[model samples]
Target: MDRKILIYPRGNGEGKGNSMSMFLCLDETTLPPDTKLFVKFLLRVISQTPTKSDDFEFKVENHFGPSCLNWGAQKFMSIVKLNDPKKGYLVGDTCIAEANVTLIGEVTTAS
Candidate 1:
């Protein structure tokens, strides 16, 4: 099934906050079946500069399990994927977050 990705972040100086909005694109088939993975994909794409590595990067955190200990932010940085380089979504959550968010064709990754 195709999923609509959604993310909300609060930070930075207004006029440019949206520039830092994170984006994630998963190759659909990578996600496991019958299982809901609560993950946050943080992406920092350099639109105008055209650089290889970002000056900053967004973080995707997934929460799962009873204690939700497995889905901490520590695992996020290592798992997030950028569209330009196109690494695809990386899943490593042993726990699910309280957020059961569905992606809705975001402005960031839709390009």
Candidate 2:
């Protein structure tokens, strides 16, 4: 399956979930350490098929737009694993879609 690395929230508060609601997210830095719950991590495309060693992760990024209070971008943690859309691309229906990421993660643990 075609896949990418996805960054998301660790919990439900501060804006996080299927809603894609505006939320404050952290920049490349400022992410907390020693996080046992969830943290952001970027990795290369791992596969085109499912594998046994596929490990995925997401971090809480500050919210965006007016609803999220335009926190600009901060950081949080992730609590879910999103799958590819059966009929749409990742983070679709946006002006700057190519630059926007709906979700991301390794695919099949390709080596």
lDDT by residue for model 2 (5-96), tens: 23332323454453222232334322223211122223221222334143322234332221222232222222222234321222232111
Q: Estimate each model's TM-score.
A: 0.25, 0.17
Please list the residue runs of candidate 1 whose C-alpha ends up more than 4 Å from where it truly belongs after superposition.
4-35, 38-40, 53-55, 63-111
Highest lDDT model number:
1
Candidate 1 residue-wise lDDT at 65: 24
Error of 1 at 17 (Å): 7.4
Candidate 2 weakest ten by summed lDDT? 90-99
10 residues in a row with least lDDT, candidate 1: 88-97
